[model samples]
Target: MRFKEWDDYIDCLLRQVKFRPDHDDIRAEYEEHLEDLYGELVSCGVPEDEAAKDAVRSMGDPVEAGKLLNSVHNAFLGWLERLLRWAMALLIVLSVIPLLSVALAGGESLIGMAGGYRDTQEHGALVYSVPVGESVALDNHTISFDEVRLYEDGVFELRYRDRLHLFDRAVKWSYDLGFSEVRDGNGNTAKGGSGSGGGSFLSRHQQYFEGFSPDIRKLVIERRGSEYAYKGRDFRIEIDLSGAKEAAGL
Candidate 1:
């Protein structure tokens, strides 16, 4: 027997198998076993042709082996197993998509928050900036005051963020910083400023007011009510502008 003869024997055996998909794997396994047996017989002093013949004989009748393998490799079972493997892979990919989307959205929001002031400052010259880290708790939400900026164009910018308490129940709500009124130390009230705010968990707000007296010593932000359905309690944020005024030589 030769190598060609061994291949012919395997082809004959697989002809009886019903599951066509398992033919390659079964062929490789049978070939490996035959090679090992043939090598052993030749190492024991048997001729190459005789070793191949003995190896094939030791494996038994091809028809009988094929019938046994056909029973084990049922066509239905092989296809079902392949389908299940594919389904499992698809499920894993589907599960990860939403998580990746949420992560990307959150990353973009943080980048915006970090660079928001710099983008706003590009429009005009920055005259003075004062960091006034303050917080006011309303119900389960806490509003934080980050800083105040004055531009040479008479625009007063207030930057803040609103966040929910860590252990608070999840609820859908939004606060508009534009709803708050700005008052100077001289009792002059300035209302209706343009602003923009957005975020997923921690919301960022930027309110821009104009025409402030450069000699102003202090400023106050008073919020009486909200335009949204969830009207929060009244609150006040008093910002000392003395530092800003002095820095700007006022």
Candidate 2:
């Protein structure tokens, strides 16, 4: 078991084992196991390199070692994946209450409207719409709005907001029919920009697009209660659906 060229020999063996199509983590575990056995051998009486060769002898076949390592590592990875999935499920369940609270609060103000909304994938575009008042004149295949209704107390008022995709301009629109909240955001990584101070609408919007890059010419649309913000390479569009159900025409 005591040989001089042990480390070099074991290295060659391990390299050869890798060519047999074993799992990578299995190979890594066996590699570490071999190193530990070598350390124990040296600690007893053998020379450094000789101890390594003795260690390799005790390791059985390289293919067998790889199989054992595969069993252990597969179990470990399965456990880790389950833990991650449970963590995600827990996070989503906990977040639901807070999200509902915000939606309810936003629905209370005059700028807020009560209605059902739907999102459809059609005509190579994503469409969202809210039907106000009777809901009949609103429900349709196309997402574009022809009319909207704003509700204050028990009164219903008509309003309209148009959608457009513009490029190379920083455009802002007022969510309130009377221009109550403006979704104008300006900030950099340094200054803690405009979104921090103005427009709760924009603050929530920035959260939605946390990792997305922004376009300087992006269009900002302010509906009654929320901001629909999106950026593209040549063009950008931000839709404010804050008080969308009550806009004007429905």
Candidate 3:
């Protein structure tokens, strides 16, 4: 719509703008320019209303002008604006993907977080035993590798009676240790999951892992060369699972 006054003309030109720290400055500059135009037209014997109309009309389409002004004031310009917007959007997508993945993984992630809920649920009941019955020394600490379960796929558990607070952090995942690894009979490393280590000073420290290679003759658990070295030795154990299927009667 055409505007008849300077205030109306400036408002029309900036109606679509939502962002601007410079809106007042821009409006004042436009008002001064239009006032000069109106004065020149009146001096030439033009009517007041006609002069105002002519001045506002000469500024072009209000909507388009507003768009131009918004673009000029927005921080990023042209292709740089487009690129940065896309990059920020992509970062949000990448971030949400993990949370979505965990959510989509059913209640397993939640159970994992509740830290031993698997042992209480029906799925945990399906967790049959594959005996490891081995131990390794770290400082004065003796970490005993215990049972394994084939149904849960690479899950293993261990406890240390001699020392609590085994690692710097009370609980840590297998990936936290450079030395800790789950290897199948063929010597290929198996996928490891969240394992934890934390307990009271007087209490035994228990930790579990979610990782197992199916139908393997035996699996080796070792954490020898990692940064969490124990008296210059790497912690290691072996689970003879050649008869795991028969043992669990699966």
Candidate 4:
């Protein structure tokens, strides 16, 4: 559906600006935007011609807008945003390739990467799972330890199975579940494994740490006293890595 009024505004604007690929894109976007606004106004008891004029007016100073866009589209900055998007999308697809290939080949892939009931391999990693005897009570929910895993590259992860109904079930590991000798990370990814209604609750926490020596035998993850005062006593997770020394091929 072509609006004569909209086409006129775009034609007038384009005349003031040099013809370029960017201008075409901008013109198309503006056309859609104006059409939407016009449709909305018509739905709300506004005449089509009046709506078209009002929409163009709202954009303000057609000549100035065209000049600004002409400058923007010419510079490297014009295509930078789109270039970055394509780059990021390509990177994501590349990263998923390894996982997808392994899965399709029937090799041991996401079978254990996710909190699945698979045997943890100890060849390259001190991979194994163990249950926790204690549980931490936070507000209305009690977080019980489901399992803990130590990967090949010293990548440590904790899986919590039981989670009560709640919107935000974030645990401040530094304050809530403190690892006295471990270090905290700035940006981390936590994917809820095996939850109700697909993935409402249940979480897996990955953390990095320091303070390891050649003789260091175990990685102890302990929580500092809770500040919420919900759970009275403090509990800890001790991952025995007698075979961990060999994981690094030391």
lDDT of 1 by residue, 132-245 (tens): 898888777788888888877777777888775645776746656553367777667764365554465566777777666855778887777658733767777788887676
**In candidate 2, what are the lDDT values of residues 125-244, reduced to their tens digit?**
322233321111111111122222212322121223222222213343422122222122342111111111122221111111121122222213232323432212111224344544
Highest lDDT against the true fold, candidate: 1
In terms of lDDT, which candidate is stronger, 3 or 4? Answer: 3
Model 4, position 164: C-alpha lDDT score:
40
Better of 1 and 2 by lDDT: 1
lDDT (C-alpha) at residue 182 in model 4: 38
Q: In order, what lDDT does every prediction score?
A: 0.78, 0.37, 0.59, 0.55
For each candidate in turn, the TM-score is 0.55, 0.26, 0.38, 0.30
TM-score, prediction 2: 0.26
Worst 10 residues of 3 by lDDT: 197-206
Considering every candidate listed, which one attains the maximal TM-score? 1
User: By TM-score, highest first, what's the ranking?
Assistant: 1, 3, 4, 2
> Model 4 — which ten-residue stretch has the worst lDDT?
191-200
Which digits, one per residue and each the tens of the lDDT, describe model 4 over residues 1-250?
6767778888777766664556778888889888887788889988877887887777777788778777756646656777898999999999898767634533332232354434434325554444445476655456566555555544555544434434454652322243442322222222222221112233333333322332444555444555765346555555555665466455
lDDT of 4: 0.55
Which window of ten consecutive residues has the lowest lDDT sum in model 2? 134-143
